[model samples]
Target: MGEVTGEVIVITSGKGGVGKTTTTANIGTGLAKLGKRVVLVDTDIGLRNLDVVLGLENRIVYNVVDVVEGTCKLKQALIKDKRAEGLCLLPAAQTRDKSAVTPEQMAEVAKELKAEFDYVIMDSPAGIEQGFKNAIAGADRGIIVTTPEMSAVRDADRIIGLLEANEMQDLKLVVNRIRSDMVERGDMMSAEDVVEVLGINLIGVVPDDEKIVIATNNGEPLAGDESLAGQAYINICHRILGEDVPYLDLRKKKGFLAKLFGKN
Candidate 1:
């Protein structure tokens, strides 16, 4: 529940539109639900959505840029989540780009947050650039989020290579937006395939659920819902804590004879 120095974990993806921000939000919230002091930093400056997803956009008088510029202390910029205790968000500045902050500044912020929180979870902007570098600079652990599509998997491979070059230990993978029906029909790559292709330990796999879109639009994380996606994220938190959680069977169930054959 308390730590003198916390672990910094970056949730990143090489391509956009792969649910990186949403994963970060839910993972941070899920950890907070377990009574861990968690802080989610939005490193996607200019195109900030973490605040919106957490429903704290109007509460943001200051941002990460302000913290980096010394205009406001880190504590002053954090927006506490009313939905979960021990959870806070350091939002990105909508007016600034990734260049607004440097890798060293990000490390400094992480160090400061570590003293107060048990986990410093960063939501890195999609791609391998200054923003991604800044996001990973302070992290002792990294989680790469990717879908099972070919493009996503290819980008994830490149990101993993980059993470290795950065000497980031404890790197893991989270396959997001998996389609059960497609997998059952052999129309899409399975989670196991993604793990094999990426060559990293699979931390979690989120099923494709329509509720996630509604949750994001309503400014609530899908993890609070009882849907498959929600439970997947909760399981992700447990895995982050080093728990040996079982993966959910999200494949579609067919006729008795079809079920006899089992999923593809």
Candidate 2:
């Protein structure tokens, strides 16, 4: 209508160790690669990894708490990415706990960021406590990341309910760390199955790629990868921007010889 405002989307998963930070870094990088001004906020106060994933760990002189506490200005706290022209990061304070800043503080920070960037992506801490509330305080949309495992899926379902209960309308799901081989073996749940159980729109599906681990170890993001999972994350970014980019095919490939041998 009157020039749509920027969207604040939180990349969250209720359960920990389900690739929530990975999704945030990749999506933020993908959005920036699309020539959109993007700012990634790490709201996982006690345990922060977004900075490491984005390779901005060494560059973080000030953090979100510094800005919120008036020790530094917002501009000072923002760590500009060297690779992505329009990408910046507001890392969390490792020394501070989740209660250091309130949800209102997080919302205020996101509001200021939305005025400057096309997208403000928040990396929320796991659980349904104050940290989780702070992460989504300023978000207009939510992207829940989960693996195919029962534990992650169960946590994701709870997260969706909490988001809805908090009056956050726009909700999307991203099933991460999916193994096509497992699905082919009838051992893993399909993307459609996860969506049906959660009852939300599927934004994308990321495979359990070894390249992602390598990238993370190298202080890089999978979004810059040419791998299958990388392509999927990139497509998810396009969808966030209202593009109709289709999802990538993550089906496991079978060897011709194996097929001829009737290998299952």
Candidate 3:
């Protein structure tokens, strides 16, 4: 048989507070739930939180630093997910700076990981700094996460440009925390607007929901839930697997005349 290879995707954002880590945790868990051996790597280095989001913080004995420093094997540093069978996490070191590991080292580690797992999701640090470079060191693809706001959309555009500069050609967008009510009122940017601005393939559109925070507070991803945002993540997982999944109805009804027709 031919040599097996898997996807190495870096999930990132240009600015902070765009729910990048949360999206990574959910998507990683969702992919594993679909029976794809998935590993979520926290490349946030000094500000590691993917472990906490996945509820694997208390179980970490070795980290990415250890793996890169040759103190431990990659298998030794991987902390498997509690809920998902095949999901695991290689958490970042909270004390080490971004300079602790070189891009070459990260790329080597990712190469080994992609050989064993079906997907390697890197939770990139916010900003276009060294941490960002390290996060995308070996990524074959990139997913930019942003909100339905002007600033977020702007930052996402910048991140997309950086990803292209890095030669990561397979780039996509995931618009999160979209408030349909506000979009309908013309107060929030719709998914179509963000896509038009960024000019990238739209992969996922996650709605704003309280369940996401609740799931994070409980140290779990909102993957198995039935909430709108949770279901959105599930659909995203399917799309990642090359499935032709259509987006759900996120728009609300206007007046009867507008509803019966197609426009207001």
- lDDT computed for candidate 1: 0.91
Q: What overall lDDT goes with each candidate model?
A: 0.91, 0.90, 0.90
> Stretches of candidate 1 above 4 Å error?
1-3, 252-264
Please report the candidate that would top lDDT against the real structure: 1
lDDT per residue for candidate 1 within 176-225, as digits (tens), equals 98998899789999999999888899999999888888888988886645
Please write out the lDDT profile of model 3 over residues 47-68, one tens digit for every residue.
9999888998899999999999
Q: Write the residue-wise lDDT of candidate 2 on 1-264 in tens digits.
A: 225568899989999999989899999888888899999999999898899999999998999999999999999999999987789999999999999999999999999888888899999998989999999999999999999989999999999998999899999999988888888788999888899888999999898888899988987776856888889989999899888987777876668987888657
Model 3 alpha-carbon miss at residue 18, Å? 0.2
Cα lDDT, model 3, residue 158? 91
Ordered by lDDT, highest first, the candidates read: 1, 2, 3
Which candidate, 1 or 2, has the higher lDDT?
A: 1
What are the root-mean-square deviations of the candidates from the true structure over C-alphas?
3.0, 2.4, 3.5
Q: What's the number of clashes in each of the models?
A: 0, 0, 0
